[model samples]
Target: MIVLGVESSCDETGLALYDTQHGLLSHALYSQVAMHEEYGGVVPELASRDHIRRAIPLLQQALADAKLAPQDIDAIAYTQGPGLAGALLVGSSVACSLGLALDKPVLGIHHLEGHLLSPLLAKEPPEFPFIALLVSGGHTQLMRVDGVGQYTLLGETLDDAAGEAFDKSAKLLGLGYPGGPAISRLAEFGDPLAYKLPRPMLHSKDFNFSFSGLKTAVLTVVKNHEEKVIANICEQDKANIARGFVDAIVDVLTAKCVNALKHTGLKRLVIAGGVGANSQLRASLNEAAAKKRFKVYYPELEFCTDNGAMIAFAGAMRLQINPDAAQRDYSFNVRPRWPLDEIKVV
Candidate 1:
């Protein structure tokens, strides 16, 4: 089966085609990061408008790359929820419209589910019954994944997600928007011992996480520093703070994942979502996995963010698992705050 996936849950406009027999055929994405940079964050209305502008052209690009026409697409899938309402509506409308035009079955895929199952599209994917650490933009969670749609929430953040901590802390350090990469980049030059930030819930003995305190710790350091003024803090000082923050987050995440593995007795671990692309976290996880004699898996760098390929691949997997999941009806509603476990198979 050929599945065309649409992902416009946030700032990125992505469209892709996945063939059940041949894997991912083509995907095209346009990120609105630059557009939103000046504003310091995403503007929902502008994001929605850009999606409306980019969706069709991206779809055409994807189709042209795949060497197929709309009729050749066997089904359509779209991220249905857990995002901005306006953004979700734009993708939903575009996908359903195409499904109506092609007379194809349409499926509303949960956005998190798309991220959860993305690693399966890797060349050497892990088998079922593994642990998954999903660190997306607003979500930081650990789950026991048995199979497609078979996810058990193991733990999650009580307040700010890891990505939020990154963004908020980066703002404190005067780093530009989309803070994870920027802060992490600056962290490389920092001395790990210069500023030691707190690692919230590091020893909670439970799988749950909390990064809000950590972010606050960064703020506290910034405001209470004995050195230069906030605006006058040197680049090196900012980098040290960034390093401290990143290390703290990395240590907490790595420890939690390790403990989760020990608790679940699962040897294989899959990392997904945007924050999964963090070099420090990946390195920390790899080191732990190597020492503990377990395996760690990750999606290719491109699939780590919001994209249509994961959605399409997830849809194809669902259909392959149960074809009835798809619906011929084109009418649909967008979900702005859907939970992951709510989609569990009965």
Candidate 2:
């Protein structure tokens, strides 16, 4: 089956074509990061408008790259929600319209489910009944994934997610927007012992996570630095603080993941979402996996963020498992706040 996926959940617009027999054919993504950088965060109105401008052209490019026409697409899949309503609408409307035009089946996929299943796109995919750590900008969660749509929520953040903590702490250190990468990069120059930060909920006897306190700790540190004339803060200071923040987060995340694995007795661990791309986190997890004699899996870097390829791949998986999951009806609605546990096998 040939499935075309559209992803406009937030600041990025993505389009891709996936062939069940051939894997991902072609994919294109246009990030609104540069545009949103000026505002220090995403402005939903601007994001929605950019998606409108980029979606069609990206779709065209993806099709051209795949050497196929629009009619060749047998099905259309779009992220139906758990994102900006406007952004979700852009992808949903476009996908349903395409399905209607081609008289093909259309499926509405949960955004988080797309991320959760993305690791299957990797060269060495994890088998069923694995643990998934989904750490994204808007969400941080651990799930016991038995198979497609068979996700049992292990735990999630009570407040700010790990990615949000990274971004918020980066901003406190005078870093620009999309702070996860910036903070991670700056931490490379930091002395691990230069500062110490709190690791919230690290020992909480549960799979749940909490980063809000960690972010607040960063704020307190930044305020102390500002008290001594912000200009007096040196580059090394920023790096040190970044390192402290990163270490704290990594520790909490790693501990929780290990705890979850032990609790579930699952050896295969899959990390998905943008924060899963963090080098520090990966290193920590890899070392732990080796020491624990378990395996770790990750999506290709390209699939780490919000992208159409994951959406298409997820949709294809759903269709493969239950062909009736796809509907001929073009009407659709998006869920900007859908929960992953709510997803069920068709």
True lDDT of residue 230, candidate 1: 71
Tell me which residue pairs clash in candidate 2: 82-335, 82-336
Per-prediction TM-score: 0.99, 0.98
Going through the candidates in order, what is the number of backbone clashes in each? 0, 2
Distance (Å) between predicted and true CA of 244, model 1?
A: 0.5
In model 1, the runs with Cα more than 4 Å from the true position are: none
Q: Each candidate's lDDT (Cα)?
A: 0.94, 0.93
What's the distance in Å from true for residue 176, model 1? 1.3
Candidate 2 regions exceeding 4 Å error are: none
* The candidate that achieves the highest lDDT relative to the unseen native structure: 1
Compared with the true structure, what per-residue lDDT tens digits does model 2 show for residues 187-272? 99999998899989888888888889999998888778755654567999989999999999999889988999999888999999
Candidate 1: tens digits of C-alpha lDDT, residues 289-344: 99999999999999999999999998999999889888988888988989899995
Worst 10 residues of 1 by lDDT: 223-232
| RMSD in angstroms between candidate 1 and the native structure over all alpha carbons | 0.9
